[model samples]
Target: MRFVAKRQKEGVNVSDTHPLVEASTLIVGLAAIFAIIAVALIFVVELALYFVSAEDEANLFGDWLPDDLITVAPNDERLYQTQLLVDRLASHWPGAPYTFRVEIDDSEIANAMALPGGLIIVTQGLLNQVESENELAFVLGHELGHFRNRDHIRALGRGIVLSMFFAVVTGNDAAGIGIKAADITLRGFSRRQETRADEFGLGLVHSEYGHVDESWRLFERWNIDGSSFLDLVTYLSTHPETGDRIADMKRHAELERWPVDGEITDLSW
Candidate 1:
């Protein structure tokens, strides 16, 4: 009887958890499992990227990227600015193995990106938004860092893998859907990766311009137009928060005793 009573007590205790508590526990466990999976996948991507050459990654995906940049004339002001930035920013990268290129897309989204094959695309909106060439240098150098670390290629591989997996699971998305998925995925990266790129960019800016001024203005102005909670979250999830970036940048500048304030060179033709 004592043994039976003890067994019953143990079973009762096991079932005593509130329904809500059990539900919460299940949710947390699933979330943890998902987090672990995501981290593992990113680690795998990082390892794969280490072995893949930047040029090869570029060649694999370079042919398919939507080249809206090709529409603008080579001498167009935005295009010219992009070319000059490539020369000013990318030239300083010593023993750089990959060829660097920049193109300007006619858009108001205020964005830029680097493709695997040393292609950098700057939007017209980004050109208009920046207050100075120094700001532009920071932006370009940040993208360049993506190339140096081959993060762009890692992102490219992730997108392709996910899109293919989704297609296999759903068996519904068409080829166009896959293409769009790739574009969307390329737009995001892990926050740690982005911060490293910022460091790379800021270091390059210091090397070239001898100082950084008004770097915060680049992000502040963009957010001023009202970065919504969702947009802010979405952007920050992959890139460090704007305030954090500015704060770190200032700390580095102070440590290096780099120039804090200087003349704002116009970002123009």
Candidate 2:
């Protein structure tokens, strides 16, 4: 009986030590589980952002500019001509629907924009500054490239996703979080998307009219004669850098062997 008790006491001691080992193991296991959950949550948030951004882009543009605002000036032959150019370029994308609207804003902001649902807006300032139809086509093609790749939607998605991530991580309001996300998203587009748009825009210009130099010339004109600082604040707010973008356009043109000389059509809007 005494021998059995002595062995039993030894067993109890070993069992006590076993728990220390098991406790350490349990802590490590739990930590790994938490880490996995964190990673999974991050992925889920990113995926959710992608879809949310696309939807938000559609909604935001839809709400801001109703179809009623898309008016064309009478005798605006240039506006019609711009639309025709945009249509011809967009046709290359195969079943891509686009609408061109010329917003005659005398804001001195030389800019054109493509919104979702085939909406294109060109400031009168932009029309006035462009030297030729080819340069205008280049700008329009770049905007259309954005639409073709659904870049705005992707940008919105990235913003929403990032906002959700920060909100969840920091426990902030979704609205505030979303604003921060948008700020980040607009700071700079993905390098890949920017390159793709540049290439696509160059291809369109080269294919349609063979006026690749127009792209570079347009950028030079904007740099030299674009709106003043206060005027450009709004323009640069959306379009960050002018010089670098121009450089990129030039590089892409050279790489693609686009023609250096082509007549700039005298179509002033």
Candidate 3:
């Protein structure tokens, strides 16, 4: 008994590692290692997006989506007109491997998004905000640029890896992480992606309509008056500034000899 006490006091004969402690340490180590890996994956995907074109990437995610999430645009006159506009404008963009599919979202968010494999969603609030078909066409053209360059897939992968990092830190409960990533992914594109989309859309609109100035008018029409602090999210967080974007559009139109002012396309608004 005395010998045991002595040994215990010395701690030389005792096991230094407790089972609970070892387990917790292992979990922490794994979380850290995996977090690094996940971060690396995000960077890898960002780089990979440069080489991969739209035709090469295919996503069947729509099949897994429930009917409630996606509503096929009804045969309403507005939808018919929107579809006609999309089809006519899309014709000007070449080498599109997947046939474009447009659907209406029931949400009130004044926004749009592109998914992998030629999927596009336009929200109810977005439709309500557009003053004319030309404005809507600009919005559509931007989303199409996302599809054409496969920005959607790159963004999705980036979001997933980031969410994984969140899950690891949250002990695998990353619902908040998922929500944040979704908000970021859906609301705005990366600076490079956004610039590319703008270039694509502005060029397409110019090519199709002959006037590019009013394309920036959509920016003006999106009123943030009486908006809460949260309303500045897209403006503050990841997106390029709206003023800068309008200026860029003007400069680009000037460079391309694209019309900033000319006979504006007549839309039956």
- Clash number for every model? 0, 2, 0
Sorted on TM-score, best first, the list reads 1, 3, 2
Q: How would you encode candidate 1's per-residue C-alpha lDDT over 1-269 as one tens digit per residue?
A: 35444433456546778999987776666545444544456678878877877767666655554644544577787677667777777778986757776777766656778776777887776776677888888988989989888877777766665655555537543334443433344444556678788878887887787777876677766466575444445446456678878878788778878887777787676
TM-score of 3: 0.70
lDDT of each: 0.70, 0.64, 0.68
Q: What is the lDDT of candidate 3?
A: 0.68
Superposed by TM-score, candidate 1 places the C-alpha of residue 226 at a distance from the truth, in angstroms, of 4.1
TM-score-wise, the better of 2 and 3 is 3
Query: Candidate 2: where is the Cα deviation over 4 Å?
Result: 1-64, 67-75, 97-106, 155-182, 190-192
Q: Which of 1 and 2 is ahead in lDDT? A: 1
Q: Which 10 successive residues of model 2 have the least lDDT summed?
A: 174-183
lDDT of 2 by residue, 135-240 (tens): 8878888877777777655555555655555565475442343444444443444555666776787888887886675776766765787445554565565664
RMSD after Cα superposition, model 2: 10.6
lDDT of 3 by residue, 125-239 (tens): 6776677667888888888888776777777886777665565558545345444544454444376788788888888888788887578776764434435234335433645
| Predicted structure with the largest TM-score when compared to the true one | 1
